[model samples]
Target: MKRKSNIKVIRIPIPTPTLLPHTTTNSYLIGNEEESILVDAGYDTEDTRKLLEWEINKHGLARPKRIVLTHAHQDHAPGVRMLIHWMPTILCHEKEEEQVLSAISPWEEITLIEDEDSIKVDGEEIIVMHTPGHTLGHVSLYIPSEQILIVGDNIVAEGTTWIGAPDGDMKDYLQTLQRLRNLKIEKIGPGHGKWVHQPHEHIDFVIQRRLHREQQLLTLLEKHQQITSKELTEIIYQDRIHPSVFPVAQKTIEAHLDKLLKEDLIQYDESKSSYVSPHF
Candidate 1:
């Protein structure tokens, strides 16, 4: 792919069930020529492809090379089969190989890209970094020349990202943010939410927010020594929080509990959703 010298980003909005409008996932069409690579595919529905096709035709794209995912979120990983049905490969974070292999993904074929991985598209090289926390295999894509970081769910531009249990980690997520701070990023192309104008500053803010949430989790567990995940989630999510986002938050708290349990900070008895803190 050759640089057209008139390249720009074309965004396709996918709004699912959420507090945010038109922002479940954003499929970014980035190119320096008529051929472009898609960042993330929308939900697993015909509408996603139709919307993308409309955008592709509208932009006069001559070719679709590859489709990329920030992580294997249901909303973000869909339509890869549709994409690979036409394109060469659907690139994913190498950490996501299991997600892809598990057929948990709606796609058939996917190539993994890990941290320190790079790909050439439209005369530009995109670097991949394993920014896990949202998911063990979640990745952040970076364009060195552009100073842009196409982060998946590690850090949403606006609200905080979920560090749900089973995979998400508060410690890793904070470290990922710190890792990004070391990079000279100018624009943050997030998987969801608005574009981040102040790159590193926004990342710092996100890190602070995650740490605060971790503290809140610690306090919540200390206050309620014995509570079911459902009950804890409800208590954690106040009236102001959207119900749609609670499930994810619940998973995040569960993830923290699992971690704390491993560190002997907390003990859990699955028969009861209660968690006991050693420090308490």
Candidate 2:
């Protein structure tokens, strides 16, 4: 890809954060001189594609070379079929291949990628960073030239990202946050909510919040001796989030407990079916 001129990053906001108060997911149209790439086509309907297409046309952008996904979550990869109709290649981390395939089946034209891989749009290069933990294959794209990072679900601007177990891991999520914080990012385009103008500040806020929450959980456990994850969720997140979101919040709290367990600060008692602090 040759840089005919300075590259442009266009935010194509699609309202899709149904569970949260967020109004939209920031789908980006990135391009430079000759080619463009669409990041996270998650709208899940033809209307999404139409909106994207209209944006492309409205800006006079070149047809995208490919549609790249940050992860396999429904809100990030749903418009795959519609984007494929335009003959653009679908790209995602190889680790998320199965999850993406499951969403849009019988479509095998995806270009699987790995961490540290570089994607070229026109003449510019977008480096891929495997920032998992939100999901097994979550990735973020970094443009060295512009110092802009397209952080998928690894971090969000509006509300904190949910790190549920089985798929999401608090340990990995925290590690990923630390790794990204070291990056030279000027602007952050997240999968949800608006763009983050102060990249490092926003990342610091997210990391501190999670750590603070974990500390709160630890204090609660120290006093209770042993408690079920649900019990901890109630104590720590009660009234902070809606009741309907408690189930997911419990899963996140469990991730924190699991991380603590891994650190030998806590232990899960099989007989009690609860987690106990190290003091116990």
Candidate 3:
């Protein structure tokens, strides 16, 4: 689909065996007649490969010269294996090299990118923004001409993006959200769901929701004295989340705990195998 600017963006929802509620990952074909860039290939499957090829052929988009991955998640980057025939130059943040390589083949050459790197597609500049949080190397592409931002997994159309431990960080995620809110964005093409029109408002909602959850965790920590992340998740989410999502919720709770611990607001009790307020 053509946006307000000269660039064309076609959102192809590729089916993937991802987490609950997210049945497909949105891979975008963005560019003009001169060149095209495919953002985020879905999981490695014949179905995914066929769908992507169909979309490209239907749109008559030129063979994408490059494949820019937002992160190295299974649902996002593994499909690069299917596109090896295109010999497209793979691009991703330096921090994501290890994971990206693991997802694809180790022998595949990857070009590392940093913040502010500009990719010219048919004369239009697409600025890369390293919006780490959901993952250490997550990036969002910005089109200054169209005031559009294509966020990989930073912001979704429905609910909230998971900020779990290890790969995900609550502190970094909050900072990323604040940074995105300051951008001159009119539309957002997220990794999942439909396009977001109220960019700032959507960003603000995510920010506020995270902050509220953080505050709730603090309050619970104070009330419970020493509580495990799993226990905290049970209290915070209760029966709202499915049994299958319990582990994900617990990981997110652990991320919040890690943030609070770093801030010296909470302390982990080794003996109790739980977290507690610093004063406790």
Candidate 4:
């Protein structure tokens, strides 16, 4: 566990069976000694539960009375099952209710939250911002006093966060980044990996990198005339990613295609099962 800022912000990196390069999901303890909130629960495992409890005791902070979820991802929300003994009130965005419910038992208590809603921990306010893109109900917590943002999977310490279809939207993700960039954030505690100290610069890099990928898709479509998302994924990320991640890369490409198609920047050839540049 690591502490940040003048406030009692403890980052508890709980081990989980997450994706490669990220073996643990960050569960944060934010509040004063009297009352606190736990953000994200990691995966559902006895070990994860014990580690979290141990960390809280070790830090000498009160057991979190609330568990605020950023989203309903497997690695982030499943651990609530183990914490059912604690009976902490589970809170998530309204849009995420279905997913969160599906992950936990029916008897668990849940509260729906929305954008601009404030959660207080010992008089300190943590504002919830609906930052979708990673997921429809993804939220990032803002601590005005410390100028810190706790982003789930929206912004990672390493490579960019994956924005694929069904749950992910490239367009919404890009807009979320822009919105976060406008905030006066001093540091960001992401769901995985180390903390992000340079918030704006990192947000800008994520934005530009996504735009650059979109441009790459457009350029590839213009040259190839007609290309499937699978083909585009191969050409764009060939050798840079492992075969296991190809499906994810393809989905991201499809999301980009969806955005471009909506903007009339590209056209889809339904009969050919491929996308083409408008000029083509």
Query: Candidate 1 — worst ten consecutive residues by lDDT sum?
Result: 15-24
Per-residue lDDT, model 1, residue 221, is 72
Q: Candidate 3 residues 202-272, lDDT tens each?
A: 99999999889899999998788888988899988879977877888788778888999899999988997
Alpha-carbon runs more than 4 Å astray in model 2: 1-5
Worst 10 residues of 2 by lDDT: 1-10
State the displacement of the C-alpha of residue 10, model 4, in Å, after optimal TM-score superposition.
1.2
Ranking by lDDT: 3, 4, 2, 1
For residues 1-280, what per-residue lDDT tens digits would candidate 2 score against the true structure? 3224367888887866545755677788999446899998876787788889899888878888688888877777877777777777888888888998887665667899899999888778889999888889888999888888999887778878889867898989989999999998778998777889999999999899899999998889889998999888888875988776788789889888888888998999999899987788
**lDDT per residue as tens, model 4, 53-98:** 8888888788887999999888999999998878789999998989
Off by over 4 Å in 1: 1-6, 17-23, 101-107, 269-271
Best by TM-score: 3
lDDT of each: 0.72, 0.84, 0.88, 0.87
* Clashing residue pairs for model 2: 1-122, 1-123, 2-122, 2-123
How does candidate 4 fare on TM-score? 0.95
